[model samples]
Target: MTKIFEMPLYPYTRTADQDAAAPVRHTAMIVGAGPVGLAAAIDLAEQGVPVVVLDDNDRVSFGSRAICFAKRQLEILDRLGCGQPMVDKGVVWNLGKVFFGDRRVYDFNLLPEEGHHRPAFINLQQYHLEDRLVARVRDLQRQGAEIELRGGNRVQAVDDLGDRVRLGIDTPEGPYTVETDWLIACDGAGSPIRSMLDLDFVGRVFEDNFLIADVVMEAEFPTERWFWFDPPFNPGQSALLHKQPDGVWRIDLQLGWDIDKEEEKTPERVIPRLRQMLGDEVAFELEWVSIYTFQCRRMERFRHNRVIFAGDSAHQVSPFGARGANSGIQDADNLAWKLGLVIQGRAPEGLLDSYDAERIAAADENILNSTRSTDFITPKSEISRLFRDAVLDLSEHYDFARPLVNSGRLSLPSVYDGSPLNADDALEGGPARTRPGAPCPDAPAGEGYLLDRLGGAFTILTLDAEAPERVSEAGIDAARVALSAGDDPTGALAERYLGAARSAIYLIRPDQHVAGRWPAYDEARIRAAIRRATGQE
Candidate 1:
C-alpha cells in the first residue's frame, strides 16, 4: 500500500545557484527538512525573512519515530499556521496509568486545568507530522512566502567563513556551492554537519536497549498512556503502550544491555513477544520495528558564529519523555524570531546569544529529566532496583508517593528563570506561572484564546488596564491587546494575569513568552522592557 510518506513530496530539482558565477548568499539557510528545520523556515518566512531548507531525502521519514507531541509544541505549531490539522489528525490524551508488574500503581492527568485550547499530549506518527509541516510550507509558498524546500540536497562539506557559511551540497544532478549569512542545522542526532565541524556530544548513554514496534490492529485499549514496570510478559523489564492516529499502536519493550539488537528486531522474535503481550487470538501486522539505546547528550553550544544547530543536532534525550522532537520544535521557536530580528537589523547580533543561553538551559533541563527517568526506568545497581521497586510499591496505595514514581517526568515548557532578556517583575502579587521568562498560559479571551492573539510580535496585554494602541521602542513595535474580566466569562484571565492586583499589563515576546509585567501601563517601563526583550537594553 502506498502511503503519504512513501511518495516523493519534494523531488530533486536543479536550481540557478548550480550555474551561478558566485555562490548566491541567502539570509538564512536550514539544513534537513525535518520538523525543526521546516518549522524554523516557516517561522522566518512568516516574519518576512527569506529562508531555504535543504534535505537529502524527498519523502517523509520511514517510521513512526516520535509519536508524542506536547501541548506547548501544539501552541507553537498554531503560531506557525499548521496546528489545527495536526490536532485534527492526532490522538489526544491526558491520562496516563503506571503499573508495577501486573498491578496498577496509579493514574495521572497531565492537563488537570481547563481554558487551554490544546490537550496535554497528542499521539501522531513522525511521518504524519513531517507531511503536515511540508504541506504548511506549500501553503506558505502559495501565499507568496519567500521560503524554499530543496530535496535531495545533501551537504557534503561546510566552511564557516566568520561572517557567512559556505556549503558544498550534493544533489541528484550534481554538486553546487552556496552561501548563507546564517546556517541552521536541524539534522538528526548523528549529525553529519556536527561531525564536519568536529563537534561532539558530552553526556551519558545508558547501557539499555528498547525495542519500538508500530503495530496495526483493531484493539480495545483506551486512548491513554500505559507504562508497565517489570511486567510478566517482559519480566524484569519495562514496557509502554499508546494509540496513534490510525489503527497503529506504539509499543516499547525494554531489552537489557547484553541482547543482540538485530536478532531481537526480527519478526520471528518480535511476533511471539506481541502474542504474549496481547493474547494469541489478537491479530496485528507490524508496520515498523527498530531498537534504540537510551542516550542523554547534547552539544556544548548550539551556535558557533554563523552556523547554528537546532533539534537533535543540539541535544538528545531518552524517548520515554517524548522530549526529543518537542524540544527541537522549541529550539526552532526560540531561534526563528531572534534570527529574523538580527538579519533585519532590528536587533543586534547579541540577541542570537540569548538563543544559545535559553535553548541550552532548555536542553540541560530536558537532559536532566531524561537522565532521571532513565535511571528510574533502568536502574543500574541491585540496590537501585530495590529502591525503585519499593517506591513503585508504595505509590500504589499512597498519594504522596505517586510523585516519586518517575515514568518519565513528562515534557513541559521550560521557564527561562533569570534570563538576560527578562525585565524585573513589576506587577505586585501577580501569578508566578506568567512571570517574565515563562510561556504565557492560555486563557479564554472573547471568542478565541489568549495565545492566538499574543504571538508573532511583541505584544502588551492589558488586563483591566489601559495601554496605547501601539508602542515602538528602538524600531520594534509592540501592539496592544486590551481585555477585561468580562471578555472571559470564566474569570480565568483575571486569575492568571491579575492575582491580587486590580489591573495589570504583560509584555509578551514574539514567541509568546512573557518579557515583563506591571500593574499599570507605563510607557517608559514598557519601552525599557521592549528593549530588554530585544537585547537592546
Candidate 2:
C-alpha cells in the first residue's frame, strides 16, 4: 500500500486505457460509517475541514445493540444539533425500578435532586440514533462540506506517509487509493485499523451469556426500567424488561446453563424463557432475538502512527450502562477539533497526541465502570453470587448501603487533564486552572440561552466584567463565538456553578468542555487558548 500522505488523492490527468486512475485528495479519510465515524465526519466538516468517510455496510442496521444514552452523551449530541430530534423521538426515563424477586424493592430517579438544567438519561434504540445521525451527515454532505460517503467501500490497508496518510480501499468496481492529511478509524471492536497497527486490547470476557429479545407487546408496562435481581423463573440468572420506542420492549434472559450457541439464539427458546419470567398472561411478538456475551477490553493505546482509533476501534465496554456508543461519540467529539487544527496548519501535529491519551483515559474509566456494573449484576462465581445476594439482602434494612444501591458513577463526565494536550499547570494562571480538561459543567446563563447556548460552538465567558472587552480587542471572531459577562451571577449558582473570580476568561470547545480558561487576561493567552479550543492554534 502506498503511504497515505504522499499518495495523490485526485486524478491529475485521466488515462484512456481500460484500467484508468483518478486521484482526488481529501483533508481526512475516515474508516467505518457507524454513528461514531459519521459523527467525526460531520464535526470535522462543521469546522470547515474537508473529510471522506467510507463504510462497508450498504444500509443501516435494524437490530438494536445499545439502548440508552447518558446525560453527557446527550450534551455532546445536542452540540452536534441531533439531540433535540433524538429526544423528541426517544423515551426519557427519570426513574428506574429494581426488583428483589417478585417484590418491588425500590424506585430510583437519576437526576432526582438536580434541577431541570440537567434531566434524566434517555432510552433510544441504537438504530434510531444512527438513522438520525446518518440523515444529518447526508444533509451536511449535500451542502458541499466535502464529506464523501462511499457505503460499499472498505479500507483494505492504511499506510502512514509521515507528513500525510494514504489508504488503499477495496470496492466492487475495483481497488482505489486515497491520500489524505490524516486517517481516523471508527470501525468496530474487531477493527482492521487497530489490527494493522498491532495494538493489543487488554481485558476479560465474562462467562455469563445474555439472551436478548426485542419484542412488540400490547400490554402496558412501567415506563421506568425494571431489573429483577434473581427471578424465580431463573434462580441463578437476571431478567430485565424495558420499554422502547413505539410499543417495542426489550427483554434480556441470562442463559445460566451453557447451550450450543447456534441452537439457543432461536426465538423458540427465548420466547419460552420470557413466558417463564413473566408467566403466560403476557402476550407478545418477538421481533428479534440473539445471544450476547460481555467483553471488557481496551487497547494499550488509542493512536498508532497517523491512524487513530475511535468508537469500538479503540475500546469496548460490556454495554451495562450504554457506554459503547456514548464513549465512542465522546471520542469523536474530542478528536474532531484537534484533527481539523492540525490539517489547517493552525496547530502543531503534536496536538493530535491528546486524541489517544484523553480518549484512552475516558475509555479506560468506561470499561472499568461498565465492567464493574455487568459483573455486579451478573456475578460469575458462587461466592460472588452469595456476596451479591447478601448486598441485596442488606439493602432491605441498611440505610448506609443506599448510596451503593443507587450508584450513579457511570453517568458522570470523564476527566481528561491527564493528557499531553492539557497544560493545567501552565502559565495561564488560576481560573484556567479551575476548568481543567473535562466536560464543561452546565451552569445556567441568562436570557433564553441558558446552558444550551454554551455548546455546539466556541464560547468565551468573562466573570471579571472587564475580560470580555479585553478578549474582543484580541480579534476574536464574534459571529461563531459568543461572549458573555457574568457580572453578578445568581448566588444559587455562584459557588457550585460558576466560580467567583476576577479577570477570568473561559474558552469552551465545540464539545462543550472548557478547553482552557485563565484568571488573568493576556492577549497571547486568550488567542492561544481560543485557537487551541477551535483547532486553530
Candidate 3:
C-alpha cells in the first residue's frame, strides 16, 4: 500500500519566473519546505503577506524523524488552523517514567493542570507533520492566500543585497534567478544558505552516539514515555522508548563513543539489541534506523541583514528534550508576525531584531537544558557517574531527589524575560505567570478557549474591566474582548489572568505574547505600549 509521505505532494511545476526577463521579486521567500518553512509560509500568508517556499525535494521527510510535539507547539498549530488533525493522528501522552537499572525510579506528569485544550505532548512522525502542513498550505491557497510551495526548486546560491536578497535557483527545468525583500532559511542543519553567507555554529558536541530504531510492532504498552539509565538490556548506557501513530514504536539505545556507527545500524547489530530489550515473546520488525551524536549548538545571531535563519538553520540541540522541531516551529511563530508587520509598514524594521533576541534566548535555554540532560545521561567522569547514580537511587524513595533526575527536561515554552517589547507591569497584583514578558496561559472563556480569540492581531482582553470596543493608534487597531468572571464556569480565566486584581486589562501581541497589563484601561498608556511592542518607541 502507498503511504502519505511516499507521494510527491508538491511536485515540481515550472513557474513564469523562469521565463522572466529579469529576476522576479517576492515579498517573502522561504528556503526548505520542512516543518519550519511551511509553518512560516502559512503564517505569513494567513496575515495576507505573499510568500513562496522552495525545496529541493517534493515529498515529506522519511521515517519518524521527530515524534514528540509539545503542548505549546500544538497551540501554535491551532492558531495556524491545523492543530486538530495532528492531535487526532498522534498519540497523546503526559505521563513519563524514569527507570534506574531494572526498577522504576519515579514517574512524572507533564501537564497536571486542567482547562488546557491540548495535551502535554503528542507522538507523530515528522513525515505526517509535513503532510499536514502541506495540506494547510493548500487550504490557504484555496482561500485566496498568496502562498506558493515550489518543490524541486533548490537554491544554488544566495547574494544578500543591502535592501533585498537575490537567489540563484536550480529546478528540474533549468536554472533561474529571483529576488526577495526578505529571505528566511529553514533548511536543515547543513544549511546551504548559512554556508553561502559564511556563518558557523558555536557549541559542544558530545563524544557519544545513540541508535534510533523505528520499530513496527504490536504491543500492549500504555502510551507513556519510558527512559532508562544503565539498564541490564544495554548496561552502562541509556535508552528511551516512545509510541507513535500506527503500529510504530521509537527506540533509542545509547552506544558509547568508540563504536562503528555504520555497523551498529545494520539489522544484525540492531535486532539483537532489540531482542535483549523487548525479549523473545514480542514480535517486531525494524522500519528505519539511524545513528546520531549529541550536539548543543546555535548561530551567534539568527538574523543577518535581509536573510534570516530559522529552525535547524539557526540552531540545533540534542534530540533528548524534543526541542529540535518544537523550537524551530516557535522560530516560525516569532518571525512571521514581526516580518508581516514590517512588510506592511505598520511596524518599524527594528521589530525584526526582537526576533533575533527572543529566539536566541530561547535557543540558549533549549541548548542549556539539552546539555544538562546529555551530561546526566552520559556522565563525563567517575564523579559525575556516581552523582547520577546516587540521584537515581534516592529518587525511587525520596521526593526531594526526584527533581534531580533529568531524563531530558522535556520541552517548555520560553518566557521572553527582559524583552525590549515588554511594557511596565502596572497590574500590581496580577499573576506572575502572565507577566509582561510571559506567554499567556490558556483558560476557559465564555464558549471556547481564551487563546482562540487572542492571536492574529493586537488585542485588549478585559476581565470585569470596562474598555472601548476598539482602540486605534498610529493606524494599527487593537480590538477589545470583554469578559466577566461569570463567563468561565471553572474560574480558570480569573485564576490565570486576574489572580488578585478584581478587574484587569491585557495587551496581547499578534503572536499571543503579553505586551502589557493594567488595572484599568488608560488610552495614553495603551497607545504607548502599542508603540513599544511594535518597536516604534
At residue 395, give the lDDT of candidate 1. Answer: 96
lDDT of 1 by residue, 233-312 (tens): 99999999999988999999998999998999999999999888999989999999999999999999999998899999
Number of colliding residue pairs in model 2: 14
TM-score: the better of candidates 2 and 3: 3
Q: What is the C-alpha RMSD of each candidate to the true structure, in Å?
A: 0.8, 6.3, 0.8
Query: How many residue pairs clash in all the candidates, one count each?
Result: 0, 14, 0
Q: What is the C-alpha local distance difference test score of candidate 3?
A: 0.94
Report the lDDT tens digits of candidate 3 across residue range 266-384.
99999999999999999999989999999999999999999999999999999999999999999999899999999999989999999999999999999999999999999999999
Per-residue lDDT over 1-537 for candidate 2, one digit per residue giving the tens place of the 0 to 100 score: 432222222212222211536545567888887789878988888888888777776555556677778777777777776888888888788787776777666677777544245456777777778778877877776787777667667778777788677777776667777777778889898998877666768888887788888887876786787777877887767777778887778888778547777688876677788788767998888767788888889888777767788888888877566688878888898889777767776666777777777788888788788777787887778998787777777776776654565222445667777555443333233433245576665545564333476656556655533454334322334222333445224432334324454345566655666666666545677666665544344
Give per-residue lDDT, candidate 1, residue 38: 91
Candidate 1 stretches greater than 4 Å from native: none
Top-down lDDT ranking: 3, 1, 2
Quick one: how many clashes does candidate 1 have?
0
Clashing pairs in 1: none
